[model samples]
Target: MNRLHPLSAVTYAIQYGFLWLWVPIVLVLALGGIFDPISPAWSPIAAPLGFLAGAAYGIAYYYRFEYGITPDTFDVASGVFARRSREIPYGRIQNVDVRQGVLQRLLGLAIVSIETAGGGNTEASLNFVSESEANRLQDQIRRRTAYVKEQRRTKQRSANEGEQQGSQRPTEPDADSSDADRTGAVSGAETDTPSDPTAVPPDRADRTDPDSTPVDGEEPDAERRAYASEPDRQRRQRLFDLQARELLLYSFTSFRPAAVAAVLFVFFLATDPIIDLLVATAQPVGGPQEIGEGTATNYGILTVVSMINGIVITYLLSVAYTFATYYDFELGRTGEDFVYERGLLQRYSGSIPVEKVQSVTVTANPLQRLIGYAGLWVETAGYGPESSGGSQSAVPLAEQSRVHRFTENLTDVETPTFRSPPTMARRRYLVRYSLVAAVIVAAVFGLAQVTALEGWYFAAVVFVAVPPAAHLKYVHIGYFVGENHLVVRSGFWQRRTTVIPYYRIQTVSTRRSIFQRRLGLASLVIDTASSRTFFWGTPTIYDVDLEDAREAHTAGRKRLQSALRERARDDDLGLTVDFT
Candidate 1:
């Protein structure tokens, strides 16, 4: 039995980081000495007592997650006394996921998840376990179901072969094939047996046997042999099954707004500097006395411990928290669609049928670029702005070559390359960004000059630099459509693009800033199932653009509506004609 879920290491790290599960409560007891400054019992008794209790609770709470699957169903049961179990039939299983967090990657644990056909809730969850086991389980379940299907298919094929061969009885499997089917069940078994699992070719040896004879009403031996796969064909099939296993857990990536939002958490921490500045100015103390006292050193100390320490810890923990919270990631492919299951606490999952995919996009972040990795996004319809917010996705990071190869392999179509507008076309965008930055900087500079916030602090105002930042941000913008996919790429250091399908677009909306209006350009807003916005009517988060923005915005929704109406109209006309 595997002792841990793949997610075990990551979850425990999170428990300690986010909840301070390991930091002993005795730290508080030790603080009593500081406040009292006279207490002597704090060390020998209070500290140990507090530490012991805290450590106990921490250890107990750390192991509270359980997840796995049995032969019949996949499930996860966790929590102390009050446990929850979610199980789904093997056939109904739509997706099974294996995920590795930063810590889990190091510890080599993986969390396995199963998604059913339709759900607005988490159907099953496994907290942590061995990565290999989770993978094996995933393969096992997929195989069990697929193998059963193949078995039925093989049986059907045999029957068809029987019909084609005109055989009275189906062919019996050899001992080796049966054993192989038992071990490989779903996928591998298909190979050991033949692709046409059902057909039976009558043995010619029986015709020569002294005691063997065909039963009455049975077909001729020649007809029975006609339905079976030739020796060469069977060999080819075995090789194909072995080869296809590489595509088993097929890799996936989508434009992750959740990740982007989480990354933008930097802005949240950056706000504290502004607050500190305000507090410093508003304080009446430290006027002239600061020159004689250690106020400068005190500020430096505060910067080192309070500002730097808090910010660094917050940033590190934020990344961990975000991964645990949002990228509770999963990816799997079904009949004609690719499904992505992600998010923490409250899970969110979205699936995109390949036919509906509007585009495939590739992008890179500075950190990722250095290592030759990039982010990928898929844009689709029925969930994007046309309905309310345009549906788009950013997903699994991958190497450029891996993405290219997977695209071609999965779709069975040569990958299509989409080209964007000329770089010069974006000159106006720089102007727009420059003007916006200028307005902000000028206002801040004006306020500083008028308020005397600092004496001749003219040099410090260089922080108002905007032209370079805005220009860099503009250079990264690219938008294009390829095959059935619509793609858009933007962002400066961390480039990103979204590939949304035409039909997954639930809604589409457009927004325009007054400045953009002045330039005779409108912004196109695209939104998807970003959890932050799943309400009715307008979407909460969308991209704003200024092109054929308005018309292109509703293109998907209008097309769908027209198709549905036409379908309805066609059905009604048939009813009125009453040809039957």
Candidate 2:
């Protein structure tokens, strides 16, 4: 090891302590098969190996760990044997997220997370830096990114002499002085050498200039200036005030449903054991009703009833958990980025650069259908197979108009006309499929025997309920292809709509199952990364609610087919997409 930082020693120590706690587990395995025998051959060999294994954890974290901010990259290098480095260009950084778990908070430390497009693997964490240092680092990164952007711009404009010029951009902070200071600084640099501003190396200038201004009217220089800006701490404080607007936007979005689902799922899983316990206790002893257990006594119907009771309790618990975690979710706009932050306990924050967004999807469930609530998701790129969520959503659910404006404002593109799915034409498919379901329900009622009122009654119930429900889901299934993007919206009870950026599409496949194939209908699956509309970021939704809906949505879908297919499709349709 070259050397360890002062804190590396503590970090290593903690790693070792945690590793040592695994001793019992290792000991158990050893005793089960090998550790017990103290043979001359085994004792000497095993002892050293075991000691080394135990010691590796601490040495490993220390040796593998690294963190630094390079001029072009903010990087974290770690991983013992595999050796991984997450280095993101200052330009690639989308945002900075900071958090402090209870332990870190107690230690007065903050963990800084750097967010980048397609750079999720890094979830790169700082061991624990002082809270103030963490903030400073974040601010510093913003500064460096701005400075670097400036350097690139200057390079672009200075062309043939770029190499010599960019190499000398100033390193000093932007001198935020009055006109007097600006003039003085320019003159001061000149006094030192008297070189023309254009002649000065861009790199040297960026390195030295705290407040560097771009030359007037040059395109490349203007672009960089557009992206980079000095930090204004005051604006950071205003972020809180914008939180409410974000929350309002998030309320109707699919994020709310997804969050609700996730929390409920966690709680449902957690409470299952308790429900099982309750059911076990509720059962009667002995008799014909009892289950086989240590007790020989039989119980009455109480066991089954208790289980039902338990299920009820578990469901309620899950609902409660949903309410708790996503109680006040927020998703809003800040400058050119969309911010998403939520959670009552385990809070999470994320952002999307307006340019990185690929598409959006909207959906709804039966409940949402009644309430005029819907969910929306946005898709972007740089996320692939290993991504945590396949579907990247923006606002999971929102009122229709709000969702439109959200998409419109975020993209700075016109909201293409919204087309509700064909209610009757598509209803044909749902009705046909639901007919099968109605038959099944009728069969069940037939076996139960009352077959008179119950017969017509059950069949009528099925015939009426199934198609209506299915139609609701189908009729709402529609998609829209806009200037630069595409959207697919569907769902009756639990409605969902997804918007995907054409730029981010990886693949689009049209599939047909045996049933659908027989029906001459097919479902189109658009594969993408974590999308705001995707449930848990999963890119696929099942069973086409509309046979022709896919056809109607083909323009955007074809964009993802193949290089040739995309070109041909766009050519045929004459789509003029502006790539930023």
Candidate 3:
């Protein structure tokens, strides 16, 4: 058993007691009373009082909170008045995360967060522990958890063997009796010869047979055979690794629209302030005539300077953001998990269980494609694409050839040959895109009518692009159903190929909207534990022929069921972890 660091009092006060102390300060300020200590006039006096209060609360909390690790369970006792104690068994623990901010690092301390299976919140958090202690504790917990799981599996195997031998014991008795009689005759032992084998006395026939007995406490041949037939554990293998040059290349290739937009927004915000400063400085030196005479030229020069500054600012911000987020990206395979590590300022170390991964995606934007590189993203059981807010990429950038190798490691399936949707589906895509273009044109025309808008005709020019864009989109929308995986490739500019294992899929359905039905086309929708595609509509194989859609659905469903059966067998053998 151990207590947190002495400085934990300060951390706890800031973390838990800040609200309590600040509320009174806010109330005093709002009331506007000179007598109130936290009022603006008397704020100097309020600081000491708040500090004393925080110190008291922190000390009390430090004394009440305690944590300890037993052989199999991690126990935590915490409370100021109404104490609560929790015990988390090692077997159920899923993640042991350690984090340290600047202040914590300066104090040589870290926070250890323990998360368990099927729980949304952390099971326990030990704050302000020694950094080295946190790391040691995390390692010990993981090692013990693995050891416990192995012991449970061994017990299960032994119990199963016992049940199997018990079932076979009844049939073996008769054969053993005949063998024993033969042995007795050969050894010249006197034995009663019954007219019928069935007429033998039950007590006499119940004697143990030497032939059926295990020698030297060894296992039976049948049990040995069963053990031999069990599947081998997954071997550790390297898939893809990012080097220094590759990581630098990845920074340039990783183009995020959201980030670019943010830079542009910052540029826009800065332009007004800078232009106002220039105008303000010039206003004092110039009369109305002089100002009017040079106003157009001054505005031109300011516009040019601002444009240059904005571009430079955007470039620097983009580079800084990329470097900060993915400074030393690395992905590798361990026995049962794919370990992803990166970050310069705030280090991250996440080990994603291979079996928990639901789907993988190999994607390339225009810039990355030009560099002959692609990125990988994984969707796991709990982390869906929509909710995976950080960089979802497992391999931030790798050569196209390396992508297939990484996928094979994660999926245990080969890169599939994609088959495009029926050519007739192009009409649906074109119609949908044209309708969108028409809506935009209608909005522009309405704007022209309401306001003095110029170049309303220019908006109509967007119709020229609709056909080509729709055609490319149609060409890219393809699906492949492999022996054990489903691959879907889509997108016109930013191409993506998603590979999902059959076992990950939960449902398969063929859908037909009114328009799709009219065109004799249907969508094949495969739902997995976590859907990774970022589409407004369903993540599906859209606008395929009706019969093909049915076939795809049937094939996917059959494979899913087969995978479920295999998983069930693994469960029975105690090979799979029980997350719940």
Give the top-scoring candidate (TM-score): 3
- Go through the candidates in order and give each one's C-alpha lDDT: 0.46, 0.52, 0.65
lDDT of 1 by residue, 1-580 (tens): 1235434544555454435432334464556657877355544555455545544444554465544444445555555457665666655664456665666657766666665544323466556656555554554454444434445545655455445457565577676677666567645533455432222122432331222344454454432343232321222111011011121111211132444455447547787675465345433433222323445434434344445444444555555554543343545443234545554443443444343344445566666666666644444433331123223343355556765454444333334353443343355656666677666667767766775334334534444555566566655655443333345566656565555444334556666666656555554555543322242222211223455565566565675465445433332111110001
- Candidate 3 regions off by >4 Å? 14-18, 29-47, 102-107, 119-121, 151-240, 257-316, 383-392, 448-453, 531-539, 570-580
lDDT per residue (tens digit) for residues 1-580 in model 3: 5688888887777755554566556656877664544447655566557766776777889988888756657889998878899999876876676776667767788888786654335688888788766755655465555555555644655556456557874543455468768677645522222122112122221111112344456454543343234311122244456787877787766554556689667658897776565555444444122324555445445546556655666666666667766777665544345555566666555455545566778888877888888877776554321233211567778787777676775566666787887777898888888999999999989977986566788898989988898888898899998987889888757787888778878888888999998989998887766533343123588888898888888898898889777654443321111110
Cα deviation at 552, candidate 3, in Å, is 1.8
Tell me model 2's lDDT, rounded to 2 decimals.
0.52
| Clashes (candidate 2) | 89
Q: Give me candidate 3's TM-score against the actual structure.
A: 0.73
Candidate 2 vs candidate 3, TM-score winner: 3
Candidate 2 per-residue lDDT over residues 447-552, each given as its tens digit: 5575222334545555566656676556666655566566666655455556555645666677766766555555666665443324334444345545454664
Of candidates 3 and 1, the better by TM-score: 3
- Model 3: number of backbone collisions: 0
- Collision count for each candidate, in order: 73, 89, 0
Better of 1 and 2 by lDDT: 2
